[model samples]
Target chain A: MEVVLMDILGAVVTFLVAFVVGMTYGGLSRKITARVQNRKGPPFYQNFIDAFKLGSKKSAIHHGVMHHFGPAFLMVSSVMTLMIVPVLTHNQWFPNLNFQGDLIFLLYVMTFGPLGMALGAGQTGNPNSAIGVTRGLSQMVGFEIPWVLALVALMIQYHTTSITGLMAAQAHSGTWLMFSSPFAFVAAVMAMFGMFRYSPFDIVGAPTELASGPISENGGKYLFVMMSSGSVFTFAKLTLYVDLFMGGADNLLILLIKTFALYLIPVLYGVTTPRYRTEQAVRWFWGWPSFFGLLAILQAVFF
Target chain B: MMNDKNSQKIVDIIQNWARKHSIWVLAYGTGCGAIEIPPTMTSRYDAERLGVRGAATPRQADVLLITGYLTVKTMKRVIRVYEQMQDPKYVIGFGSCTINGGMYYDSYNTIKVLDKYLPVDVYINGCMPRPEAVLSGFAQLQKRIAEGRANGAQQYKDNLEWYRANQKKIIPNWIMPDYNW
Candidate 1:
């Protein structure tokens, strides 16, 4: 009972932290976007404030009973995603959560929230939203297989699924996983980055084409909850990368540097690329590097 | 019995105060005025010092700050969300969208005025109001609340017909968009 209660508490705290951190990125993106367009943007807390205000308002049940559960379902999955991910060392909230097995677990757990959202969007019966969710899901189907294959290679090479354990192995060998098998690392990094819906892959929520995509129907409180979830998911993924490739650093400063360096890759890529059509993203997901990802598997196995 | 009454009274007082000070704003970024909300609430203007926070759940919010214009589609969902919020709530329409239609004034979908659909506590005027304008609107709202002049939830309840009528005028199809279908 005590452990269960602590887990809930930990989840809540992590959720809040993720929300704030994620919004900071959103604010940062907005600023970056404005600079690109030669405009002065609002402060970073803009997304935060927007989400908070909307979440607090009275939740109206629009589109009937199923819509009522949409926000609740998304919120649950988001918090659960935090629970499954290894956020802290010494395992602050969930002691059972290990870095190794948790990575694979993280992949599966994260899948549902988006699926639920796509379903909810379909329920809205708006052709645009339905089309958005369909495109988002189709994109998901194409990339997820290659992404999983890449992860499988990582697991086979390291001989562990625990994120912390993988990092520990690297520390002992005086090498990072990215160095051992650059292709796998690249493929994994790209897949994860694409998963974030940052440029080129932002088809699911394409404001231009789909009007905020699956969440087109959401407004006020519902919209805030969704944005809050997006925020926490970002931090969680960033932290996951840190654990996977750059853990075992002694002090906070080195860890921060490594983490930020890892994050910059995604940010730079996001800022530079134009949006990819659904078909093009799938082709990229399945075509070129994904084929090399198999060679990465062979390299990890034979070497 | 006395303690219960006192507790009830205390609860009422706190709720009333929360309703006023911590007005969580949902400035849906559908227009230019959406940009002004951040400065009005962040460090330079610091709306937080007044207890106003941007919340993520409707159950936790007391006020909905609709920053600017709403299209027919956006207004439909906005009305639905507004209805979900608990009573004793207030709505503040920032910039010309809430007052009149502003730039989208002649647009077919944009509501010429917000009060036509929802009860508005304050009407902030600016083509796209600046942070200062939003702050002034917040002050005006606070004043009205303090003076017992603002009765949003009560008015909404006591005059259901009026509320219904107002929403009907703005939301072309007073029927809530069925997202569940």
Candidate 2:
């Protein structure tokens, strides 16, 4: 009984911390995005207010009964992402979960909310949203491959699937994994940055091509929940990336600050660049990032 | 001195809070002019500083900041959204679309002037205004709201005929889809 209670308490605390941290990261990214564009930006509290208002708005039903599931699933997927991410601490039970897996687990698990959103949008039969959904998922397929190769190379160097272990090893070794495998790091960063879907790669719900993308049909509170979840998910993904690369998760504040730095890097990329077509993003990810990621793997092994 | 300072601080906070909440806008995004919205919300324009946001649903938005000219079809949706919005929402005609139909005035599917359809709180005169123009327009509208001079949505609800006639002209056989005309 006591063990069960402790486990429940840990899970609750973990979730609460991730929720607050994830929301903060999401909020700060919005501000960073404004700064990159030479704008003063919204208050950090804006996202929370938006989310609260969205969740409070009178529901506007769309199409069918199943349409209701999209926002619910999106919220669940976002919270689950915070739960799985070892961004806060490695002192998590089932840290290895199934196998003592590495970045591969992170990669696959991270895809769920997006995939679920895309599928849910397609099911609604809104041609615009369906097109956006199709494009977003297809873009994911292209980016994920090179991202996996980059992860594999890092795993080879560290020889463990544990993200926390990899960071600890790098911290003790006195040189960041980024220094040892700069090429892979750069390739992965670019690929993942594109995956962040800020600009250039914002083809899925290309406002020009298809209204507002998959959730374009969603309105009132429903759209709000999905968008807020997406923001939270974006922060979680960035947090995971920073924790893995920067070895900054030794303390919560350090982890947060490093994540902020990592988040800013991508937002800066977003502001300065123009959006890419879906085909353009896929080609760039598979073509250039893949090539660089491969070269880095060879260099890491043979050198 | 401390009591006076505390009271002053309380007053300042309340005023700030009120200013942030009541920014009503003209919700028209007439054409391709709507493309600038992402940058306005994103890190670039960062309208959050002004507490301005794009409300997907009409009821939650205080400002209906119209972007550009209105097509007949999009005009229908715009009217629907405007009707749904609560009172105290301000309408800022973004570009020439609301001022005089701009380029779309003589176009087959465009309305000649948006004011014929809805009350305008402020007219931002530009062919297609920049984010700066839009933001400034919002600031002007906010100033009016602060002084309690603007409450256009309620006025709109009371005088529906002027707007209805314009809408009826567009949708000649105007009846809810469920109702047989």
Q: What DockQ results do all the predictions give, each relative to the true complex?
A: 0.10, 0.20
Best by DockQ: 2
For B1-181, candidate 2 gives per-residue lDDT tens digits of 6569888776545543464453423345557667766666666676768767655445456567677877777777777666655444567777776677787777888877878887878888787677787677777776776565676766776777777877888876564432111
Clashes of 2: 21
RMSD each, Å: 6.8, 6.6
* Leading candidate by TM-score: 2
Give the Å shift of residue A6 in candidate 1: 6.5
Error of 2 at A107 (Å): 2.8
TM-score of chain A of each: 0.88, 0.88
In candidate 1, what are the lDDT values of residues A251-301, reduced to their tens digit?
434544665576667676877889999899888888755876787788879
User: DockQ score of candidate 1?
Assistant: 0.10
Docking outcome class, model 1: incorrect
- lDDT by residue for model 2 (A202-237), tens: 887566567667876575567667766776677567
TM-score of 1: 0.68
